[model samples]
Target: MSREAAEYALRARADERDRISGDLLDLESHTTYQVLKGASLRGSTEQRWTATQESLTTLWQLNDAYRAVLRRAEQIRASRARPGAEQLAALTELLAGSSVILRAAAKPVERRSLIPQTDLRLTLDEAVTRMNAAFREVTSALNDIDAVWNRVLPRLDGADADLSKIHDLESELGETAGLTAEESELARLRTAAVEDPLGATVEPHLDRLTRLLASSRAELDLAITVKREFAARRENLVAALDLVRAAESEARLAHGAVVVKIALPPQAQPRSRVGALAGELDALDVSADPWVLRAKRLARLEDDARKAAEQARTTAKALYGLIGRRDELRGRLGACEAMAARKGLAEDPAVSESFARAHALLWNAPCDLTKAAAAVENYQRAIHGGK
Candidate 1:
């Protein structure tokens, strides 16, 4: 193909590439926005299923747009009649870069349903990396085209001037019959050269090039739109995730409060074992000298000691009840932990630690109720610490 034809073809390819890129980008942005909306809805106090559906729809649309762009890019790159060797190579590189981005964007959707916040973040990171790479490739291609035009413009202008000069010379010679046959042939040759320097084949290629450039520009615009939407959606998703975490924390604290309140005994009850023990020790009226105590007083002291001992048994029963309640709370906490784990929410270290503390509290013996109470207190502190 002629040089003009080749240049036009390259332009066309560039335009098409830009157009598809724009479309893909727009879709991506929309998808990301939807994702954020869904995440926010999930984190909200009210569970709105509509947001999830919107997210799914956005993702599907983004994927479809991405595929369409890829196919068109490939088609333009492979169109032998229009794309020259250098343009083809550039197009191929662009395709490769875009494929990487497409894969990155696709991965999050595939695993979003199954993964935790951390995994989702990883997938997003990959997608962003791929997107940046694709953008870089497109930027590079645009720069290369600009550079080529810079060099070619002056040369094309000079050629046009030369053609005009040759045409003027030919017109001047046509008025002279004294010119030789060789001169006449030379004039004819000059006319032909001026009229078709690159030949008729260049026109169609130039037209194709123009079309390709327009299409590429359109695609690029779409790509930009998609990217913006994606960014917004990502931000929304992050906010939603943070809110969900806060709610989980609040729930844990509420649960801990319930556990503490239930475990504590009412303060209005009669003398507990410890209280009775103190009373018994206080009532023992030992004289300044222990030998001076009366027998009646000593008998009274012995009876009080026996009564304190009996109170200790009642205290033990009350302690058992407290321990039982503590055990039940621990069991409930364990169940919550298991449920969270099954739902992929157990990645948080605080949740794991709380689960462990609850288990320890649950398994403690009733005889060591005092120690158990202290442990339960410590467990409460740990749970608070986690928050």
Candidate 2:
């Protein structure tokens, strides 16, 4: 080993040993280690505790191993005060890596190294290579530990399962919903899971997927409700129309019960507004399976049928009372004319005028019962000498 190379190599090994010691001290005081040290580390966290404990044990072992290597390096330098060619050569070589020879405790005895597998002298170039690789194992393990705690473990706890469930349910919705958007979202979520498994991008995407999954579920429910409503709609409308017909029948019966006392000619009946409404309801778009439009049309048809039924009842009631009034008016006019004939006022022009006016009012198609009654009273008063 050259003088400069030897000095630099010794210094590097010593520095590495000091750095490892300091790092060990820092590791013992680390927040994660401290927190775990205080906790029970039971239940779901037992496995994580075991893994972290393994990493900590490896750190301790690395500390010991680095100390041993530093001691072996120091012994080589101290063996010769001057550090002659043999000493310097051995120092540089010993500083090579964990593959160097070491003496057992009883006496200085040669023992093959465990790490590198080969006995070849570790050159200056190999020294740098080994040093770079030295911290790789425990450092990588610590990183893995941190990642397991901070990322992979959290995801395993819920995120992974939630995302998978969302993807599955979204697929189900897409199956019947026939929406391209959900499939596209599932594809995007899968891509995010693959490409950014432990990245910030992934959690946000999973969150977005969750919200979208909820929205899709809501839409699915609406579609189901709309379908159920549509399936039952025809029957519902038919039932409503039946109620309308029953109500019409009741109105007709009511008219019948009252018409016997009225004693007036039967009024001409109008066309069935209820029948026209039923025809409109039957002509609705029940064939096209247009859910949204069909819902609107169905609402309109129901309203129309209801209104027609109500109007029919109202017209029947008015006709019943009109017939009663017309009959009553006819009887009153006859009584007034008879009184006038008996009192020698039957041929009077006043009697004819009052009778004609009353007849005109009561004989009209929708006879004005109010005016006919009033006219009949006027005739009576005139015949009774304004008494």
Candidate 3:
């Protein structure tokens, strides 16, 4: 071999040794130390012994190969004077060392089944899977952060203006003055709703989003807990989703029941004719006849029922109006959630900041949605309420 060839072979072997050593270190950190310690303990499985022995053997072989390569490279460096012969000798030694190390490294690849069959295997496997999921979630969260900084922050140049307008409205409506506890609370709630349509709008779809975020965080925490507690058991995403769906279904059923009650007509009973007759018979008035007076009371009751029915109709109309307003509020809340999702700000820094601002506005000592709405409406009413 030429000097150039000898140098190339030496460099290749050195590179390969470094790469393999790094991989070995990583594997050692992950598994080898634990296995060796487990093997030394009483009542340890035979599989642990086998795996440890195999790993140690591989480690020795690779170390020997690395040392041999270093020795050959040193010899080559020293024999530069005797060109061709020295080069050939050094090249041969380098090739032999490289071949040994490659073969030793190949052993692990060939004996893939050397992984221990033990109770701890399942646990370790589950830990690995959970680690992978956590890595992915972290990556996704990072991406979301990037998106918020890149896309959402730029759009918030008008936030200060909006805030100023909100303040002005508050001041104009005397919301900033000393007020009743309830009034202050309403003002706070309204400011929050206006500032962070995403976080504070809990009436419609935004409420669902808020709930979803909470649910997701809870699930992530639960998944981590389960992974640690039941390491041997695999957690399925489908199962988690099923649990959420079940809870949502139950909630919807309950809500629907409430809605049904709201929609149902109130029950009213007519006076009992038999009871009236009995009372009249007990009186037993032969001259004036108590029955005649009973008939007049029955006529009066019929008139009262008719009047009540009319009032009920009016009550139903008023309830329908309130329902419409409630639906509108729900729709607005939904729009806010959808907007946040579209902007990818539901869990990002910008959204979090917005939520904080909203909380400050709404949750200050007392919370009041009505006063805040009035404050906001006063300004809008002055500018565009007529329109």
Q: Would you list the C-alpha lDDT of every candidate in the order shown?
A: 0.44, 0.60, 0.42
Identify the runs in model 3 with alpha carbons over 4 angstroms from their true place. Answer: 30-53, 96-387
Cα RMSD for candidate 3? 32.3
RMSD of each: 40.6, 19.2, 32.3
What is the alpha-carbon lDDT of model 3 when measured against the actual structure? 0.42
Considering lDDT, which of the candidate structures 1 and 3 is the better prediction for this target?
Answer: 1
Write model 3 residue lDDT over 48-164, tens digit each, in one string: 334445545544544554556567565766667655775676566556423333241333555656664332212212332333454344334334333433443332323333344
Sort by lDDT, top down from the best: 2, 1, 3
Q: Output the better candidate (1/3) by TM-score.
A: 3
Question: What tens digits encode model 1's per-residue C-alpha lDDT throughout 1-387?
Answer: 444553454466457547656855664465333333443321121122344343444444444444454555557655666667676555554443333232233445656655434312212223334444554443443344334344443444444444444344434432221224423433443343323222213334334433443443333333334344544543443444344444434434433444443434344133323344334334533333222132234344445545544454444455445646666666656656666667665666765665565566566432234444554554454445532
Against the true structure, whose TM-score is highest?
A: 2
> Lowest-scoring 10 consecutive residues by lDDT in candidate 1?
40-49
Pairs clashing within candidate 2: none
Q: Write the per-residue lDDT of candidate 2 for residues 1-387, one digit (tens) a residue.
A: 776687787788678667756766776676655655665443334554566565555445445545665687678777866678887766765665444322222322365444444333333344334443543543553454455456534543354454455456545434343445655655665544433333324456556655665555555555445456765877877887887787677667766665554334556343365677678776774446444345456767878778867876786787576666678779888878888889998777887788788878767655656678898888888798867
Model 2, residue 309: C-alpha shift (Å) = 1.2
